[model samples]
Target chain A: MNVQDIQRILRADLLCGEEHLGREVQTACGSDMMSDVLAYVKEQSVLLTGLVNPQVIRTAEMMDMVCIVFVRGKRPNEDMIELAKERSIVVMSTKFRMFTACGLLYEGGLKGGCKV
Target chain B: MHYVVPPDDFTRAGEASSAVKKTLKQIGMNPDVIRRVAIAMYEGEINMVIHAHGGEITVDVAPDRVDMVLADEGPGIADIERAMQAGYSTAPEEVRNLGFGAGMGLPNMKKYTDEMTVESTLGVGTTVRMSVFNHAG
Candidate 1:
């Protein structure tokens, strides 16, 4: 699915990289723990997280992830947004809880990225 | 390019990673190898900021490998074995508030790099040395 589909499905607000709405995301993982995201994620991925920090953007950049969806209505600060923008990573925020947002995206056909 | 991680700023977390990525690109390293080095070094750099206050990162670009050494003189890991555990972490709540401390930093460092070694002493400091081989060669 594309970023547009994820936004519509999760009812998310695009915070940055609106030009990337058409970018495809085939897999995703949801976690507030950046460690688990780093440990378990595979392939080019989308990160669904409620965590807000410069490290979040750094992690996305490290994993070569294309997008990050902040759950629980959390919005990233300017520094975080700027970091994502520099890395060409899309950032979005949604009012849905983590589980709900993940479920919506899963139901929308984005699969879990790692099997291990 | 070499950098001394500033002790006071959390906003500048990924500067080392960006530099390494740019250097790798300029050197025409394989894109996959560049990604691995970037991820590994970035994680190590974040660890330095959150746990060590800051550190010095030295990147050695060789014909076959990219070598990274991250050295810090802050409080060191008490137990290297436990610290190396995939889910273990010593980062405090404040650091966690910054969205880390899930304990994958070291392991991810190991995962993305072809070789890694950690040397540490409690109350002293830690040094992480890792290298990623260029597959393009």
Candidate 2:
């Protein structure tokens, strides 16, 4: 699905990378742990997490992830947003909790990649 | 290009990774090798900040191989065996808040590199050496 689909499905606010809303993402991973996101995540383009910090942006940068949706209405501070903006990674915030967000996206045909 | 890791600052965590990525791009390395080196070195950078106060990173570039050495004087790893486990972490809550602390740092380092080694001395320091060989397939 596209970033727009994810935004519409999750009712998320695009905090950055508005022009990238149409990018295609094949898989998704939900976690607040950066280490888990780094280790187990493979071919997953979207990261759903409640964690907010500079490292989140760094993790996405390292993973080559295209989008990050902050679950639970959590908004990242200026530094994080700036970092994401610099990397051109779409940043979104949704009111849906983690489970609901993952389920909704899963129902929308976004699958999770290999779990290592 | 070589750079010093300043442990007192959290904002500078990925400086080494960034530099390496830039160098890989400049040197025309394959994307896969670049990504591997970036991810592995980035993991090591985070480990340096969260565990050691700061550390030093040396990158030796070659036509077919990239060698990285990250040395830190922070508290040494007590157990290499357990630390290599996929789900063991001793990171504090604050570090966790920053999106790390899930215990996959070392493992990810291994996963993204061709060869990796860890040498540590309690209270003295720890050094992690990793290398990724370019595959021209």
Candidate 3:
């Protein structure tokens, strides 16, 4: 699915990178820990995270992820949004909690995307 | 390339890695190799910001290998083995609350790179060296 599909599935609001909404996201990983995400993720395109900080966007960029879904109604600061825009990563804010948001995405055909 | 990581600036932690990644991409480096370097360097960078009082990361890029050295002047690691273990962290509660300090930083660095070594002096400082080599795609 694409970022738009994920937005629809989880009721997310697009905060930036609107032009790239059609970007394809075959797999995703959810984590509040950036280190775990960096260690385990491979070829994933979307990141669902609860921690709101510049490092979140930086983690996604390091992993080459194209989108970030902020769970638990957490919103990124202006610096994060600016960084995401610079990195061409789509940023969204969702009201669902981490588990619920992940479940919805999984039910909507998004796999965990980890081979392990 | 040499990068000086700012002290305690969580917001600017990954700028060096990002710059290197962009350069590697522009030069047509292997995607796997580029990502490995990026992740390893990023983890080291974060460690410097969180544990060390900022540091310098120097990267040497060659046709077949990417080498990086992260040096920091902060309270050095008391136990290298313990620090390498997953989920073993010395970071404060606040750092953990920021979604880091999971004790996976060094381990993850080792996991992604081809070679890694840590040299630290207690109460003095620490330095990390890691390399990533391109395997035939």
Candidate 4:
């Protein structure tokens, strides 16, 4: 599905990268631990995380992720948004908790992107 | 490219890796190769910030490979074997609260690189060298 679909499905607000709403994403991972995300994420284009920090954006960038969904309405600070803007990564905030957000996206056919 | 990681600056830890990613992108490296290099180096960079006081990262980008050397003067790893184990972190509680220090850093660094080596002296310093080959054989 595309970024727009995720936005609508999760009732998310676009914090940055509005123009990227049309981009497609096939997989996602949800985790608060940046280390786990870095270690296990494989080709996941969307990250659903509750953690709000600049390193979250950095993690997304390092993994080549196209977007991040801040679950539980946890808004990122200006630095995080600016960093995501610089990388052209879409940032969004959702009221859904981490588990719900991941489930909704998975129900919408977005796989986990890793076989384990 | 060379970068100095400021001590305990969690926010700036990935700068070197980000710069390297941009350079590789500009030079039109393969996306897979670029991703591997970026992730590996970023892990190393984060390790420097979290474990070491700070460190120096030198990246040598070649036609066939991207090599990264991260050197830091920190409380060296007491047990290299255990440190390499997933989920065995030595990072303090504050560092864990920052969403890192899960003990996946070194393993992730090794996972993404074609070759990797670690050298450390107790109470002195540690150095990690990693390389990712440009072409998949």
Candidate 5:
């Protein structure tokens, strides 16, 4: 699915990368731990996480992820948002908790990127 | 390229890796190779901040391979074999609260890079060397 589908499914507010809402993403994974997120390699992927830090943005950037959705209504700081903006990764915040948000996205046809 | 990773600056930890990624992209390297190098180097960068008291990273890009060397003057790894395991981390609780310290750092670095080695000394420092091949055979 594309970034718009994820936004609509999760009822998320776009924090940055407004121009990239149409960007295509093949898969997604949700995790609070950046270490787990870094272990997988996905192309054109979306990252869903509750963690709010500069490392989240850096992790997405390194993995070439197209978007990051902050779960549990957690919003990142200006520095993190600015970093995501600079890297062109779409950033969004959703009120739904992690499980619900991920389930909704999965039900909306977004599949997990992990092989195991 | 050479970079001095500032000590304990978690926010700026991945700058070196990010810059190297941009350079590889601009030079028109293959996307897969670039991603491997970026991810491996990024993991190393994070490890330096979370464990070491900052470090130095040097990257050499060539037609066939890209080599990354990270050196940190921190308490060296106590056991290289155990550290290589996927779920063994010595990072403190504060680091884990920051969404890291899950113990996959070293493994992820190894997973992404084609070649990797670790050299460490007690009360001295640690150095990690990794290589990613530009071309797949």
Candidate 6:
């Protein structure tokens, strides 16, 4: 699915990178721990996380992730948004909790994309 | 390229890795190779900020490989074997609160690089050297 589909499915608000809404993402990973995300994620284009920090954007960039979905309505600060903007990474916020957000995305056919 | 990591500055930790990624992109390196270098170096950068109070990172990018050397003066790891375990972490709760310190830093660095070596002197310092080879060329 595309970022647009994820936004609609999760009732999310686009924070930035609106131009990327049409971009396709086949997989996603959900985690609050950046280390776990870094260690296990493989080719996932979307990250559903509750953590709000600049490192989130950095982690996404390092992994070449195209977008980050902040679960539980946790909004990022200006620094995070600015960093994401520089990297052209889509940032969104959703009211759904972590589990539900991952569930909705998975139910919508987004695999975990873990390389276990 | 050389970067000095300011002590405990979590927000600025990834700057070096990001710069390296941009440089690699400008040079038309393979996306996979660039991602590996970025992830490995970024993980080391975060480790420096979290545990070492700060450190120095030197990067050397060549046509066939990208090499990174991270050195820091901190309370060196007492047990390298245990520290490499997936869930073992010495980072305090505050660091964990920031969404890191999951004990995956070194392991992830090792996983993404073609070569990795760690040298630590207790109460002195630790140095991690890693290299990722360009396979797309």
DockQ of each: 0.68, 0.71, 0.88, 0.91, 0.94, 0.92
lDDT of 6 by residue, B1-137 (tens): 99998998888999989999999999999999999999999999999999999999999989999989999998998999998887889999999999998888888888999999999999999999999998877
Model 3: colliding residue pairs: none
TM-scores, all candidates, are 0.93, 0.94, 0.97, 0.97, 0.98, 0.97
Which is the winner by lDDT between candidate 2 and candidate 5?
A: 5
Model 1, runs deviating above 4 Å: none
- i-RMS, each model, one decimal: 1.5, 1.1, 0.6, 0.6, 0.6, 0.6
Docking class of 5: high
**Tens digit of per-residue lDDT, candidate 6, span A13-96:** 999999999999999999999888898757989999999899999999998899999999999998899999999999999999
Better of 1 and 4 by DockQ: 4
Ranking by DockQ: 5, 6, 4, 3, 2, 1
lDDT of 4 at A57: 97
lDDT at position B36, candidate 3? 91
Give me the runs in candidate 4 sitting further than 4 Å from their true place. Answer: none
TM-score of chain A of each: 0.95, 0.96, 0.97, 0.97, 0.96, 0.97
Q: Write the per-residue lDDT of candidate 4 for residues B30-132, one digit (tens) a residue.
A: 9999988988888888888888889999989888998889999999989999998888888999988899988898899889999999999999999999999
Tens-place lDDT per residue, model 5, B103-122, is 99999999998899999998
Assess candidate 6 and give its TM-score to the true structure. Answer: 0.97
Q: List the residue pairs that clash in candidate 5.
A: none
Which sections of candidate 3 miss by over 4 Å? Answer: none
Q: Model 1 misses residue B9 by how many Å?
A: 2.5
Lowest lDDT 10-residue stretch of candidate 6 chain B = B80-89
Error of 6 at A87 (Å): 0.5
Best by DockQ: 5
Poorly placed runs, candidate 6 (over 4 Å): none
